[model samples]
Target: MVAEAQNLKVSVWRGTGETGEFETFDVPSRESQTVLDVVSWIQQQADPTLTYRFACRVGMCGSCAMMVNGIPRWTCRTHVKKVSENNTLRIEPLRNMPVIKDLVADMDPFFDKWVSAEALHHPTSTRNDAITPVDATTPERQAADAGIECINCGICYAACDTVAGNPDYLGPAALQRAWTLLNDAKDGGRIAILDAVSGSGGCHNCHSMGSCTRYCPNELDPMSAIAGLKRETFRHALRRKRDA
Candidate 1:
């Protein structure tokens, strides 16, 4: 259908928060043109006041993530030809977050969840202490390695249904970060981190629907990380009961 068309019909959200409407624009299509390119064209050619966010054009930064035709994706990496249907495209801000403006969701809440989950590493040894060597072959190291690549793109957060149902939910990325820290051998706050993620609105709230894993751009399995948190929390609960 798009083969015969010289221009693509793109509908982009135009407002702040939930008060937006889709504004249609006819974008000229080109070979290898990406969704970001379409949005940039609309802003530059059609309307100069249109607002959006993007940093690295390459896929490494994950700064160009947005909802492309109802799916969260890195616009910098998503080619318009692949996602557009019949030469039509719909672009919107990521869901389940406060939108600051068109295509720019406030990332404060997402990062706040990371802090609430205690996702930061707590060092066990001081710099004055002897250097410690970590064995990469160990299972704990492997587990930590599995989730260490997340760039906080928030794609998985937007894809999570639990976050939609429960605003207080920690979401996948935060919980995945907690799991990575939990497996870290030199981390001093294992028990405290476990306590943080095990409470209400934490890992227990995840429905394990696998939406987070399904939309993760990095191909990381956050569902597996959440499952790991569930098991570790259960073990901790059991140990506390036995100790009591």
Candidate 2:
């Protein structure tokens, strides 16, 4: 809770199709104020037409992620005092994405790259096959477990410098998911995933800026996952050469 109530000067982006402008609002501060709360107040009181997206205000869902003061974060958990300065804030949609409206960025491109990276697991056996139990203590499981908590909020993607520069780059989340599936004992698509990530705009293009890991809301290390992909892809190339 704030020591005293004061009006916060907030600058919010309002536009469509990658083109937009900022609208300033003076919102009354409250106890334990959150950025999402300010946005909600603006929509419900100051301007009913304000556009934004949010679900599960407790931060379980990543839908409320946005750029606050030039950094991507989950607005539901971002306290206004933490990110704001002098009772002022500049809010916008997540970067490296097409703006759908005032605060909604089109996420289709991010998800599409995820598919292209073969992030989904391919089961080695059908349901008819007997259940194959996995040993959680194994090194493979440990590696895979490290990255399975990703919620696809696209925060890492928005923080990726490569994705910001090259539209074709696979980004961090997709590669991290692929690395997780590759380490899964029952997945059968290791080779396919490796091949997919080794192609153009794949893991090789990653500049290792570390922003993905630095900005991940869940504290997942996407940069390490990408590094693992690089090592495994190299090993795959060597095996192919040896076989040939």
Candidate 3:
């Protein structure tokens, strides 16, 4: 029991995979406390057995992302006072992901989906060839630059309702990557990438709810990228029909 009246009530999910319960903790409240600080205190003072992931306590690394009050946020940067209501906070592992432990979500499936979307860069020229100069003034280069800042943070994936309902959806991040690569002048996998995204679980599967863009900590508009893919794939389809 909290001996003082100025304590924060925290409910954290504790379980592996899909099975577990929310364990409540009473943490002393402070003026400048972040949610990460509360979690660290719980592990050190409350329960040493508690498990969570964090690095670079700043916002640079997104490893500290978790569901705080049903929204995915980087715990390292999120202030406790800003998100807490009535000094009560409910924390859980990221949704739409399999929990490996108390606060760790398995990221293999997310990356696998990324690969399925053909988000990787495929070179157009051999390494021995001269470096190709890309002009930033071009629309293609600008499009790629807009989303190149993504560091594979799963926050957007967790925020996407399409991913939650459709097991086959390629996801916003993956599709956004595909759009970036499609706009790259040096990318040689345009046809394959287009073909992959044009099929089932592709860009069309998106409902355009914009949840991914709305919750992105980086403020990237993945919805716009997906929209670009829709237009590109439509034009690609028309060209194929015209040639046939």
Query: Which one is best on TM-score?
Result: 2
Candidate 1 segments exceeding 4 Å error: 1-5
- Model 1 alpha-carbon miss at residue 67, Å: 0.5
If scored against the real structure, what TM-score would every candidate get?
0.96, 0.97, 0.95
**Model 2 misplaced regions, further than 4 Å:** 1-3
- Among residues 3 or more apart in sequence or in different chains, the pairs in candidate 3 whose N, CA or C atoms overlap within 3 Å are none
Q: Tell me each candidate's RMSD, in Å, in order.
A: 2.1, 1.3, 2.4
**What lDDT score goes with residue 78 in model 1?**
94
In model 2, pairs of residues that clash are none
Q: How does each model score on lDDT? A: 0.91, 0.93, 0.90
lDDT, candidate 3, 92-182, per-residue tens: 9888989999988987888898889899988888889998899999989999999878867789899999999997888988999998999
Sliding window of 10 residues with minimal summed lDDT for model 2: 1-10
Show how many residue pairs clash in every candidate, following the order shown.
Answer: 0, 0, 0
Ranking by TM-score: 2, 1, 3
- Candidate number with greatest lDDT: 2
Number of the candidate with higher lDDT, 2 or 3: 2
Q: Once model 3 is optimally superposed onto the true structure by TM-score, how far is the C-alpha of residue 56 displaced, in angstroms?
A: 2.0
Residues 36-131, candidate 1: write the lDDT tens digits: 999899999999988988988888887888999999998999999899998899999998989999999899999999999999988888989976
